[model samples]
Target chain A: MTWVYAVTLLILLISLIVGVWRVIQGPRLADRLLAAQLFGTTGVAVLLLLAELQSLPAARDTALVLALLAMLAAVAFVSRVWKVRPDSEDRP
Target chain B: MNLLIDFTLLIGILAIALTCLISRSLFRSVVFFILLGLMLAIGWIRLGAPDIALAEAAIGAGITGVLLLDTLGHLKKTGNLENDEPAPGRKRLILAIVSSFTLVGLLLWAVFNQPTPAINIHLLVTEAMPESGVSHPITAVLLNFRSYDTLLEVGVLVLAVLVGLALQTDQQAQDSLPGLPNPLLHACLTLLIPAMLITSMYLLWAGADRPGGAFQAGAMLAAAFILLHISGIKLSSQVSHRMMQAGLLLGFGVFLAVATSSLIGGRPLLTYPEGGAGMLILLIELALTLSIGLILLSLFTIANSPPHHKDQGGDHGH
Candidate 1:
């Protein structure tokens, strides 16, 4: 079971690395923003895995908070930053 | 396997932080900064500090990211987002590198050369836990044992909000950015906001027994408020101005009153009376939670509002 958690976490970390690449190689701001969203999801998964792996119940609470707040950055990005410049939708 | 996981996390955190620092685009930098925070939360968990991890999740990943994105929006609105400032001079770069290396070296040296303490603070805390009025050691330490520090910390939060308020000339300065009137966002807020509020209360309640506490819960509450504000439900307008102000100060006022109440009993400041510690700590935490929520929201709204100089100029012209 611990190995299962470790393997899942490794896979998630790999996905996060790939997401970082997209963020870095972004031809568009949307791509980077999407990558950030990916990180939020991946972070929640990682936290949950850690909670199970370590038997730390509090880590579950952290995961819950992370899951709840994950969309906030996207909401802020779309409403406040992205929508401000309709013309620069693809601008990096 | 554990070593591998920790190693990967360490490398990942450092790499992300470096990328965030060096990213040429401000937007990319901000995005990477958020990523760094997410990674750091995991790192905190790996280090076995769930309390810090929770704070990092709420404040570092959530509130700070939104604040940065909001600032970027302001910069974009002012047509300053693409302004390419010159990079630092070579001499300055060298200074920065040297200083950073020196700091790292000092930290490593300190880590390598730790002196044994004469007294085990953990032992003291364990012995004192029964009387501290909380099952959670962190809470006990924060609200009961070292409550003076908590009191001052709340004072600092209040002071920060007051400063932001002072900077605004008009009490009712309108936010320049209109609420996002997306139908889907509004629909989602129906579910999300309540969950956030419930979670906020849960975190507060959990603090007495677990890793959750006032600051993390306050940040959660602030996130909910910001979500509503952005989604077209302006809390500032819904509530009376006087009521809003009182809400912002309620925590600090309650905390101060409680701290001073101890003085009346000839106890030193912030020391709870015998057998009353639990109630007092809870009362203080309850007030602190609300005040913290409002203070954080006020900071956001204050930043969201456009500068008052333009409004003042228009008034002068009229």
Candidate 2:
């Protein structure tokens, strides 16, 4: 079971790396923001796996906080940042 | 397997940090920084420090990310987002590299040549735990044993908010970012806000026996407040100005008052009376939680508010 957790965590970390590539390669701000959102969700999964693997319950709380704040960046980007760049709105 | 996990985390953290530092796009840098924070939180957990992990999650990743993104928005509004900042000259790059390498070398040297402690401070904390008024060692250490440090830290937070407040030329300036008028966001808030509030209180309650505490709880509360503010539920406007000011000062005031009371009792300042340490710590934490929340929200709002002249110009133009 611990090994299973380890493998799952490894997979999530790999996915995070993949997500970072999108953020780095983005020709669009929305693409980068979406990749960041992927990180948030993946981060929660990693935290939860760590909690189970290490038998540390507080890691679960960290996951919960991550889950809650996951959408915040998107909200901030849309309402604050993206709204200002009207030109970027029509870009693919 | 554990070694593999640790190795991956190390590489990921280093790579993310380097990217954040070197990324030409400010927005990309901010995103990578947030990702780096997430990675660090996991690193903290791997080191068996869940308290620090929680703090990293709440403040480092959550609050700091929002603040940076908001700053980016401000920069965009001012047409400075794409301004070509001059690349570092060769001399400056060499200086930076040399200084950073020197710091890293010093750190590595210190790590390799650690001196044995004259005292087993962990043992002392364990021995004194029964008298420290809390079951959790971290909380007991933070709010009970080394509470003076916590008091000063709260004072610093309060001071930071005060500086931000002072910098605002107009107290009543409205936030330039209009409320997000999404119905889905509003629907989500109905559920999310309550959960966040409950979690904040639970964190405060858990501190007595677990890893949660005032600072983490306060950050959680601040996140909820900021969410509401972003979604158009302006907490600042809902409450009176006097009331908001009082809320911001409540934690530091209560902490100072308690510390002074201890001094008057000849307990050498900040030393709680016998049998009252637990209650006093709880009281201080409760006040700190509220004040920290208000302080963080104020910082966000102060940054979000438009400049006084801009507001006036827009008003006259309209």
The most accurate candidate by DockQ is 2
Model 1 TM-score relative to the real fold: 0.94
Measured against the true structure, the TM-scores of the candidates, in listed sequence, are: 0.94, 0.94
How far residue A47's Cα lies from its native spot in candidate 1, in Å, is 1.1
Model 2, position B28, has a per-residue lDDT of 89
Error of 1 at B305 (Å): 4.4
Model 2 per-residue lDDT tens digits across residues B27-134: 889989889888999999999999999989998888889888888877676555773678999999999999999999999999999999999999999999988888
Q: Specify the CAPRI tier of model 2.
A: medium
Any residue pairs clashing in model 2, and if so which?
Answer: none
Cα lDDT, all candidates: 0.86, 0.87
- Model 2 interface RMSD, in angstroms? 4.0
- Chain A TM-scores, one per candidate? 0.87, 0.90
Estimate, for each residue in B274-314, the C-alpha lDDT of model 1 and write its tens digit. Answer: 88898888888888888888887887788655544544433
Query: Model 1 misses residue B95 by how many Å?
Result: 0.7
